[model samples]
Target chain A: MKKLFLPFLIILLLTSCRHRLVPMIGMDSNGDEVIEHVSAVNFKSSSADVMNLVAKDTLTTLSNHKFNSGWDMNHFQVGLLINTTVGPLAWKVSATPGFRLVFKKVKK
Target chain B: MKSIILIISLITSATLFASSTLPTDWYQPSFDKGANQNTLSTPSAQADEEIDHLFSTQHKTLKRLNKNANKKWKVTDYVFMLALSKSGLLGFKALNGKSVFQVYYQKKKATPVKVEESKPIDIFVHEDMTDSDLQAQIEPVLGALVATKKIDRNTTLSGDIVERINSVKQVVGNLEASTDKKFYLSAFRIDLGINSSGILLPSWAAHKGTEVVLRLQWTRIVKKGAPKALAYKSKVNSNFQAFTESVLKDLNKIDESPLASTGKKAVKVRIGMGVTTTDAIIISSAKTTFMGNLIFKRNKKYKPSKSVVTNDYQYVIDKSIDGAKKMGQISNERFIKGLNKAVKMGGYFVRKADNSKKWKVSMLRAWYILSVQGFMGLAPITATSEIELFYK
Candidate 1:
């Protein structure tokens, strides 16, 4: 029972491991999930300021049909996928305003 | 600075740990009603919303595209014509404007009919058409309006009915032999005009305007009713003929020409009959030929100076008959005679005969082609025919 428990714990830890972060920045015209913009960006850290700014710009341009002095950011599914085949490193995030960043978190 | 760095690192670690366990609750203003709370959904509702937004945003662009398509349809409005014949017929295009599409129909399919768009079409049934057959041919086109309904089916033709259509007789082409040339009498001249008219007159107050003129060059073969064959001694000579001219002289001036010397200066208009050559086969075998041209002119304007118009028109008639066949049956012969008779008959309705001029009967050069079928003894047969006209 102890050995079975250890294997289950390992599986859970592996599934929960942090791999990458992506920042998506664009919005649907009606505040829908559909992303509408010229392009988007990807990032490893949610804290990446550049990713957020680009995402915001993309959303602002798409919804309002004009670029904003400040960045416009809206959250959308974009093309996000999390399943059995793809590892965490395969995760991608994208933003518009002409920027994309792909990075994997340093595994602890 | 050290404390601040440690604080940021701790915050990052905690955030990562949270994300690894569960993704962020993505901001969706559209879901304020808790519409998509439990499941991570790429909702179909979201796709519809995006499409609706696009339509609303580019509303003007799509509207213009629709308008352009409609305008294109207007130019080609006359996609079909319901009634047609050698003389004329009424055509209605459900989509056309006020313009009458004048399409010229050929007896043979080889001839091209001219279609005039944007002109008020003059609808006419040849005078020879029996009231019954005319109705049959026209009923389907007119939505059976003539027969099925109680509405007035009266139609005033463009020119006087050239001739009542005789289903028994076929119209002919006789630009060839002199006698065969004289059949087409001068129909009314059509002066094509652009939109609208010059006057609005009450039906009661009558007035006269300067006469609009027309000319015809045709040939006629003198036949005692209908000829059976191309024989030289065919009863053609028994028909009395007149080659008349209508000269519209000033009602107030003294007559100048020899026709006026007889104390009548009114322009002389007369209809005559004569003959020229028959078909080549007939001419080769017989002692005589069967043809003549019936020249119809505005006698008042006939002069030597305007001969250029004469030359050009003669050229047109000559070129028109290069490959036409020679002989046909009585149907073609009668039509030519009927057309000539209609001119004389219809002209009397418009003006009085001026009894004051010396008249001359002469023939002109032209050709003929046989056309149409004559119904005889319950069988329809083609007739020998000719077409002729006068220039100047």
Candidate 2:
């Protein structure tokens, strides 16, 4: 009975759900388990603004061997100096659209 | 006396040119940037909150109008459909005008699924909206919410208005049926986008970003109404299964993107990396630098000066930390995560259906994307969006 208890505890710990701070995922790549840490940022703008940015030319094609063979790199971004008026407040802005971009690994 | 006049004119001309700090062709529209209003002024979180307020407020107004259970004017029966799509163009059009969406006005057939007890909403549509016009619209929404103290002035409305509309309907539906209440007002919204497919797997190539996201509630209790619209305005027309096949078959025959307006012009570029604090920054830099290499490879005009690939590039930093300091670091870190998921969204759907294992896509993965707030937003150029690839 004591031996059975030890195995149950091990299995419980391995399969338990835990709180995630960065909200990331781990996957299998080329038969090896790969845990790539993706950024945890999100765009705080509206649907109109996002599509306008992407539809406009923000997509770039990248080639790299480090990426899995099945995927290609495409960077989608809207780096604008937004004159945002939040609630009753006024507007200030940013340059470089900063780091808010959608980097996708698409297939050829 | 004539010389004096000439000197005065010269002084005026010099003053006008003095403040022109930017280069001669700075404002010229290009692929990188633009001087358009859509490029300059963007909507805020406050603007989105107003979308919710408008629906809720319109619902309330609608309820008052629908008091007569037996009356034809009562909104007990309506016909509509959610116009959400995976195509950026179709999705954009869906929100551009009410015409693109399925509409059934006074006496159409629709079933309000479920509902909760809450006040209804008011709806409004504008022909041409300017920046200030949006602010003017938000004024009343904020005013009422703050007045009732339901929310504060500084609140950020990050909630999906589309999903909320459904929840409100579900709750109101349930409440009205169970408690014999009269919460007869409901609202619906659609926000959508086509996830970015890199230069290789362009959405134009595969009919990937096309689908249905329909929901309409004509009544808490079923009723009848006349047709408000003659036909579905969806571009891809999911009603026809052959739509995707014909579109893809035609697209496959093309050598370039269907829309020549995309400005497929590519130039030579090299990417240089800068250092930063977080390990994520280093990882992100590597990804970005690789992207730079991609641009060089994709462009026809770019020529390699040396075999080692050292020259002709754009310099990328670890983060724009020096720009605004903390914000730069925080923003870049978040971008890394978003990029990761975007890749997943892009590759997952396409890969799942791989029949020969040469990277075919599957139906289940494709559905995951369509079902998932599910993704990407902006503008008094109004649109419907789903937030995805995000963190808590």
Candidate 3:
């Protein structure tokens, strides 16, 4: 029983992590999911149109990556964990013209 | 004296010249140039001007009458003639003792006057309306005409009166044939009554059977701009079917039934669904009921029976909610939250009612009020949905 307990604990931990809940995002007027935050490296210089273009590019990149795919539950859970833990650190070290996207779910 | 005579002679010569230039018989009644020249007629010119003025006035009056015809009678030519006569425009002094109709007819002989017939008034009547009911509807219009002095009260049985009645009848008939034939989407409600043949017994009593009935009712809003032929009945039916199937599918997902039995005997469970629509705002709400036998066995797993029977009834609660949300009546979050609360409350009540027979009636009678607040800080429009539960 002691020998099996470690494996059982690991399996339990893995299973619990598999079903982690993510925040729900609000929709825009066009029914598209709205990003909670958008940050550009040169905030003062970047116009609204430029920021919008950057946001769209970021969205497309995030969409193509397997981890950020919302359609798959396992991918979404994994993405939520990784993005929260490592996303901020990566944004700090990124080059110019960089932007960070953050999504926050609405409360019930 | 010589100067005075010369001035008088000059004035006489000027008068004679003016008389010679003027046409002969200029002072005559007909003002006719004699010897086969009847060109200059004063009375004829005066008659032409009077006729033009009469027609122009009639045209303006008709336009005003037509503008108000939606709520009043469409002014016919006969009515206009009567109005003109009443206003003294067609009196003896105006038309020289001849009626306006006679002058109109006389002018029509020389130049045809275009008289536009009144357009048919749009009316809708049920096919089941009786003759007396239809007559009652038409009586107020004729009465209004008589009250306004457009029609003579004493001459109610006259030919023009009959003609006016026939014209109204034609309008009613045409409208009934066209407008009432189309179908419309109507708001509706569903009621499910569950009855069981068990005495009001304690928890230790034996089990009994149950029966259920579903009732559906709808009311239509008949208006000019109402959507026609939307296949709304079938759409409602299909939507209702989807809702029921979803409920059944969710129920089937539960691995263990709440009412588990130890012995060989089977447990009884009852479920019901009800839908209702409000008339004023077209708001639709759905209620669900769950009932079970109190006889339970601990530490045993029971499968839900697959033989639960439901009637073929339609519902519109989900569709109505979606529509309301689309129209911005309620926020999406509130909508989802309300539904989730309803399901949770339903399950909780069902379990509580099943455990104790004493609390069953009271628990079922308790209503779960799901009040949805209006969106965008508008005046709070509360949509209340009642959740009911029952058990035997």
Candidate 4:
């Protein structure tokens, strides 16, 4: 039991130190470097409604980064995925100042 | 001094780690190249070639018909006769062992028939034949017939009497023998005379025969340029068909790939910030992941699953379809405008006739027959068709 405990302790430490890469949610146009954060929301929403929620969520994300001095939050792209028990509903919204919002509903 | 240096190095390393860093493979932004972005190039050159082929075939038919004739007719003269024959304008009935020529004029709103007759002459007038030329041909025969008292001085002579006097019955006999259909030659030329006020007026107008007036009006319509208009109408129709087919083919290719099914079970919003380029924020979402609190601060790399990439491509195609729909509307408007212009150009004679109001109605009918009806028949190639073809 003493010999088994030593091996288990080493395995636990190694597993805990393992570096895991987070899923990327934002990137530059060229996609060289990316910033990643997990954002989750639960509600009944449509492609149009998701646009407003995405706007608020983006502001919250930028505020968390603390390097928001030069970034233009108004002009950005948001891809929303609504997971239902039946299937996933995907939508992309591009928000540019003075330009009309273009909503694209992605088919599964 | 050694302790201070170690502390400074540690603080600098911590600051660098907190700032932006190169993305790992799992988090690399995959740029969607999108669907084809080329402008639609219609086969106009091919359509023009088709029009030329059509005209050449018609010209060949005209030449063949003239070559087989005993007396060759001018293009306009042949067209006028063909129009009259096809329109069923010339009707004949046997009366007292002699064939009497009856003229039928078809009006869409009203049909009024009247019958009357006098002398006969088979006059072959070409497109260049003027009123004076027709008068010159008729005056000598009428003067001789009136002087001899065979016909009254004031009586309007028809083609039958002139055929009898000139012994030109062979011309009429040849025309009847050339075709299976029998046509009684009853063409007339109105004599010009001075009225009470010294104004020169057609004697037929003085007679005021509705049958004669209607026949002459129809003849005028055929002679003024219906043949050229007919040729142009055929050309426009073929071109429009070719263009419509080409546009439909292009639109169908827009969403050809079948959408891949995602087996994801949860909604995940992944917000990303560009470390090196801070111009804008990127937000992406997926259905399988629920790691909302996870952040990638290390330099470790890992490849994303195939389903994630496929989902991104689906979004790209959706965006592309939206853009193509807008372009389709613009091109459709342009095509319709061009079609209208061609129609108006082809129907120039009908629109500019002396009885324009009456002919304009005919022009509208022709427009409907040539374009509107044809377009409606091809309504399946429109937006609804696009949606069905693309989605299904």
Candidate 5:
């Protein structure tokens, strides 16, 4: 039982804490590249900080007419993974401003 | 830090109270507790049924026809299609002040069946797929056709074929000719698949309960002598396969994520992002992707001009920032690292009819991924300033 402990611990570490590369892109808006709105949600019962990274800049810019704006988009479509989190502190810690936004284009 | 926490709590409480009158489940949160409320997941029951029907019917039939050599082979035309449902609403993400992703599907046309045209055709289901592996699964379709006397063993087969591999097919190398007929094998063994738009995100698969189809079309072949036929018919468009533009990056650009180098046409880029409501289990946001043609343009000078150049790509707000690197400059540095000489010449992502225009350097890629979480669990967030630039 003692010998198996080391081996099992190593195996668990190997499988559980592996890093994954998600196919993410720069969702850089054309204008207003600042943190238009930012809020942090902490669940007292669960003890997790879910920082809301809300940049509601794209909505006002897109053409409202469906045909011209993006005739192609007609649904809410995004990829989902079972056991993956976004960042280093994703779903784990309650750090201040889980992410720091430095918008080079936006004037402070 | 205390101020930040207090501010967050204050805002959250106020927002909760504002929507207090609504039902608790109205804006349900928490991934484990409920089904994903995103656009892709809501009508999933209908999506699942439609997808199953397609697989059971059209896909099965295509596999069957690829087998039984006795059955007449129509000219192969494969199409890839993505459709978006007019939902009750695109949940919170689509409805909020955020743009969404677009899904493109290959158009389905009424196939013209030539009843008296007894010309037998042998569909070479791309050189990559093995006959034995697929034969058994779709055998029933052919068996039913033959049993009903739709086609017989003695029917003359037209050796004429159409390969529906996605890339632009060009017959490059050797040719072996029979006394009456001639056969020419294409040079590159192009392997590709269906995609999320042009982005090969995953295997362009249909979720368990939704419908997305990759279809192959067979065209009527006009047999004009061997030499003339070989001269005119170089390659046919095989629109959609199981893999796509991004998967090609699987073996080579193993480090590159979100983008798979699926097709070998030219150096192209697919930019996308996602947003969700309650569950991360189900995709609650559209993979809003856009294909930008960088390398392969009929007009060479106009290609990848702005997307790769740093100066031309600055957004209006870009200059005011103290130390902001231009999106183009970032894209240039990262993309140049992965791009080889070939994509420098070939890979170009363009619209079906508008491959002539010069590529633009815009901050927003038409679709915006907006992630907003309220009412359950730790709320959601959305950010996309880091793009994984992939090349082949």
Candidate 6:
């Protein structure tokens, strides 16, 4: 029985070594996964003078990849941004036919 | 002394067996020990639970990834096919719409052993030659070539021929009639032929199941309201067949794609004018606004490009039929001019809905009609149409 146990243990060890898991990750300066959050705001004035009081407030919120709504009765576009360990993704306002007002996270 | 020896032997064997098999119970320590024994023949309950949870998460993640991949493939394929169709039509039109002919000859078992193309071949009609004489002349030459295996005995030719002819004649009893010129069209003759003497194979065998050959001939002709026998002379260009086969190959690839799936949901978009009124004054007491909304919907597994998604909150107007009707028309030239100015300003615009129009609208009213005729960054669609309304 003792002789048989030694052979079985050796076979089990060989089989277990073949199925080891390898981790897939990247090494940055800190050797950790990188993730960031972003928020941006957009404000604009109405040339027609319909909502003049809030236009300045609207302009303050506008930034790269972020938008925020201004006061009520005001024409403004606002958004929240999220950046992750993966590639950057954007969601933004379509003010013109071909352009997007986008917002992104600040580098940590 | 013998009885004492027997008792000792039993006690020794029991200890060896007890060490070999661990107890099967829920206690953690006992379960762990049992896991290492070959004869215990049971797994720990916790291990089963861990494996189950791991597999469940993996299954769910794989499902989501598959769906996302499939959706992307569907959208890309639809766009690709639309592009290919346009490309194929444009390529053919630029070439003066010339017809192509291909021939294949088979020496053994109707297999096209040799294939060739005759492109841009001129069709000559011997006006004075009798139909029987023309046929007799061509048949002998063709037969001789086949007999010598110079041309495959099983060569097939197919093509389309378009032509128009006019002639002047004298009338026997009265004046010749004035009329439009007559037209004569020859149907292309396509066939599969093998040149047993050479190694070139027919286009049919090259394209395999992707293409079908069509053969047309000029069996009869009408000239000046009289029925006349038709005769045709054909010149062959061998390269045209290969060109056509290449085109057909691309078409087959497009058709086999997932975009070819029928009855899938389609994304529909329309751009028109919308007019509205506001209380704020620009240069006068009240402002009259005429604007366009680039209204859209993703419509089941469809997502619009980010540039086309109207993020200007004003464009999300409340549901109203009157508002929708106003969306159907512009106020006047004043409103249209003002709207165009706003468009030039680059901020997205939205229209307001009145009470009467908003209440009677249908669920289809969920979609907004874009005001501009040409929207940039617009993806190719599987189907598209436009509607124009009259003032009446």
Could you tell me the TM-score of candidate 6?
Answer: 0.15
Regarding DockQ, does 1 or 2 come out ahead? 2
List the candidates' TM-scores in order.
0.16, 0.17, 0.18, 0.14, 0.17, 0.15
The candidate, 4 or 6, that scores higher on TM-score is: 6
lDDT of 2 by residue, B156-257 (tens): 321232332333232222211111111111211212211221111211212224231112222332112323232223322221112212221221222222
* Clashes (N, CA, C under 3 Å) per candidate: 82, 58, 2, 16, 44, 53
For every candidate structure, what is the RMSD over all alpha carbons to the true structure, in angstroms? 39.2, 30.0, 45.6, 40.3, 27.0, 35.8
* Candidate 5: segments with Cα more than 4 A from true spot: A1-5, A17-108, B1-102, B106-342, B345-392
Model 3 per-residue lDDT tens digits across residues B1-392: 00000000000011111211212222111111122221222223433343343333323322332212122111122211211111111111111111121100111112222322122222223323445654565456545544654334433222332333232222221211112211112222222222342112211111112122222122222244444442223333343434433333332332222223311111111222232222111123422211111111111243445574343322222233223332213333333333333333233323422342221111122122222231110000112223222211
lDDT of 4 by residue, B1-392 (tens): 00000000000001112222211111111132231112222223433333233223323322332221112111111110000011111101111211111111111122222211222323443323444665676577556645554335444344433322222111111111011111111222222232332232332232222112101100111222234422222232332224323332222222211121211111111111110021111111111111011111111222222441111110011112122221111233322332333222223212222121211111111111111111210111001111100000
lDDT by candidate, in order shown: 0.22, 0.22, 0.25, 0.22, 0.21, 0.21
- DockQ of predictions, in order shown: 0.01, 0.01, 0.00, 0.01, 0.01, 0.01
List the candidate 1 regions with Cα displacement exceeding 4 Å. Answer: A1-108, B1-131, B141-392
Predicted complex 6: CAPRI docking category: incorrect
Per model, the share of native interface contacts recovered reads 0.00, 0.00, 0.00, 0.00, 0.00, 0.00
Best by TM-score: 3
Cα lDDT of model 1 by residue, A1-108, tens digit: 998999999887775443211211111223222111211122223213333343344434444543243432221211111111123343233222222111222234
> Could you say which candidate leads in lDDT?
3
Clashes of 6: 53
Error of 1 at A75 (Å): 56
Fill in the DockQ of model 1.
0.01
Worst 10-residue lDDT window, candidate 1 chain B: B1-10
Q: What is the TM-score of chain A alone in each candidate?
A: 0.22, 0.21, 0.24, 0.24, 0.20, 0.20
